[model samples]
Target: MSKGVIVGIDIGSTKICAVAGIMDEVGKVKILDIVEEPTQRGRVSNGTVVNLEFTAKDIDRILNVLSDKAEINIHNVIVNISGENVEGKAHQSFLTRDDSRSTIRKEEIERLAVDIRKSFRPTAGNIIIHTFPQEFIVDRAHVPDNPIGRFGITLGGNFFLISTPNDPHLALRRTIESVGVKVQNNHRFVPLKIVHTLFTPLADAMAVLSEIDKKLGVAVVNIGGDTTEIAIFQESGLRHISVIPFAGKSITNDLVKAFQILPDHAEKLKLIMGAIPPDEVGKNDIIKIPGVEGLPDKEIVAQNVSIIIEERVKEIASMVMAEIMHSGYDGQLISGVVLTGGTSNIAMIKEVFTKVTNGMNIRVGNTIRNIGQTAVAKIADPKYATVVGLVLSGFMPLDERVPEEVIWGDIPESQVSIGSYNNGFDTPNSKLNGKKEEPPQEEEQSGGGIFGWFKKKVSSAGKIDMGDDKNYTN
Candidate 1:
């Protein structure tokens, strides 16, 4: 068995959280430490870094806390990115073999994926983040999940391509690099890598979605502090993904504006009072809202709080339902909608979602199913789903032909130049130069393909192991 420590950073509009954990030879993850701090206002918005310098400082603080607690010098990390500018589109490509009798090879499948990626022309300020295959068609007669080694004269593939604005993408990388964390690599472009940037919803799906759920059709709704991300899966592939510029923070803002209360007080009321049903609250029940400075404590009816929360929660749910319908898989979600993220913790969220979707199966999603270890118990909340998934994605095996689906844009050679290095952080001469290297060539596997690399790493001797029972401070 082999083991190694990996760090995952989740940068959100409301908070910055860093998680370090150990992955065993068999892919079980044990949390070593988790550290988080409130993101300064204006530093991040809708999961995008708005203020580069302040965001960098926040990341540095979070990394320092994690490093101090884990008692390790962190060098590299997998980070997540999301925002309103992030979007997903459906695309397909076809390839024909010269000989009709020849069996389809993995390389040919990969070439088809490359063709699909090249066909996409992202807007000037945007770049493709991921391109995941939905299914493969061989010889116009058979449709298989994996077409490698199949006999065919022609092969075709349907893919889901995800893209994000370049400004936010570059800002996120710059912030991480400013903290001395390395964010450059092109190691085979495998889906399962310890250090790379990935879409937040995709990472969340990796951690929480099962193969059964994907095959049966399901939508993962991640409600973050500033955004609600939706990813729909069907036939064991990603079908649609989107970001709604509203979430828990939006609810808090509503409360603040409605009650004229401080943001902190509004948040406390939202969490403590809970989004209870209005009818459940007693007519006489009243909650006290602590006053600030010279202001006197204000008393409001519990029913009123419930009403305020219910309205916003319902609105968010309706928006999610709309996105699902737009995905064209409205009635195909056999597994229903799975709600996750910090906001999913809101009282009655599932109930609200069920009502909005007209009684579709609804449930709250957490990391308990995939994560093991008592240390992670405290962080097993829905809020940590994205970061937890980021860590878990490092251990999940990559599909054979999917490696070619990793579409990193043409990075300028100028960005490849490494500038001065100090304090474990290397400052790039320019932020725009963070280009990914070309994937290395490897012999295609007859059956296992690139997945064999994972098995070899897991079973290999002399694996790097984090020592036992080291000092870790809370």
Candidate 2:
């Protein structure tokens, strides 16, 4: 009967959105309210911060609205980071005991993770954010997902590590902190997979699928303004995740180029005249829009506009299909593709998706869960899935295993010394020791175990609430 509220924020190049909700005893979230606002032009690019100040202000406004609507105190949030630079690479790590009599234990698993993290850095200044345990093996024998109790001399784990540019992580933390909210300890490392799989998943799972098709492999494509994120679901965990650079903004750019119009005007026209089927557009359907200076107000054919935009949309669809093929998911997705995001609202988007996916059954996903069937049908837009997914993930028991540590260093170009902080803070410091010295502890992380001291705190609380202080719950 007890409930606690948490917030989820997603900062993208085109828009910033926040959702607040309460988690029930079983760790299910009931969304309270969601707030969204557009990013000022040029403030953010491809999930990276181009203007910290403006981005902070925009996020501040959205948070304020969400807080008021939800009627809850907001301090920490689970944020989403997706872009070209945010990449997921698979790697395998093995831990060998010095003594043959030694057996593999959870501590050994933690050590192996620490070792894997060491080799994660790229020459281009990237910082590790999320880690996925693909599989674990003991004594050269494949083991099930759980290996804590098994006895073995060697512990091996296959991991998919996701990282982003150090600079973006730093800048985003600075912006979020400037808005007077503390980010979670594992803010950067929290995986979106956890959110999608745990909360509102049935809907996302059903986006392009029917109940009968659940057993068949299916992929969900979220084509947003800044990033196109893909998720493939098998029987259990997600098989693959990728962030592509192509999305709605590319179509907007195409409109600007082909129409010889200002970027803003082009975006507006595309929204009004945007449609997937060129045949549906009438030749006489002309929209009057302001033309460039020295030219009269122009009358443009809506069909011509549709053709140009559809061409780009088709290309994006093709790229996603290509990715699915390359992922070796061919004939794997029985349910076909589920398309969601703000860009999914484009006129005739479902038709386009259906055509591109060919034999696969496709449907627009709606983020309606726990709500009644009627409301689910009314709010059936795909654009809000991420925000809803954020709320869904927000409600799950927080992975208190890792306290917020400063993964990215000080923000460059600013003269601010920024105070003593750790991995919880995303932005880099402008000055250190008044000499710009690197923090010594960056190389030596505290909380030696993967589920460190912070996890112990949460686990202890759970035990007390269960009226059994002698037993710890994870």
TM-score winner among the candidates? 1
TM-score of each: 0.81, 0.70
Index of the highest-lDDT prediction: 1
- Record all residue pairs in model 1 with backbone atoms less than 3 Å apart, i.e. clashing: 415-433
lDDT of 1 by residue, 8-64 (tens): 888888788888877755557877889988887788877787788877777776776
Residue-level lDDT of model 2, residues 1-474, one tens digit each, is 113665667666777777676764554455667777877788867656688788777776777676666666676565666665555565565667665465555555555555555544432466656554545667777653557767777777555555567776766665566566322432322211112111122224422334334336677788878667776654333456666667888888888888778888888877776644566788889878786777888777788789878887887787677667756676788777778877777877777767887867776675664332221233346766765555544433112221112111222222123233222222244322333324422322335222342343234231111111111111
TM-score of 1: 0.81
Clashes of each: 1, 13
Worst 10 residues of 1 by lDDT: 465-474
Which runs of model 2 end up more than 4 angstroms from their true locations? 1-3, 24-27, 96-111, 119-124, 148-153, 181-216, 232-241, 275-279, 290-295, 369-380, 397-474
Q: Whole-model Cα lDDT per candidate?
A: 0.71, 0.58
**What C-alpha lDDT does candidate 1 achieve relative to the native structure?**
0.71
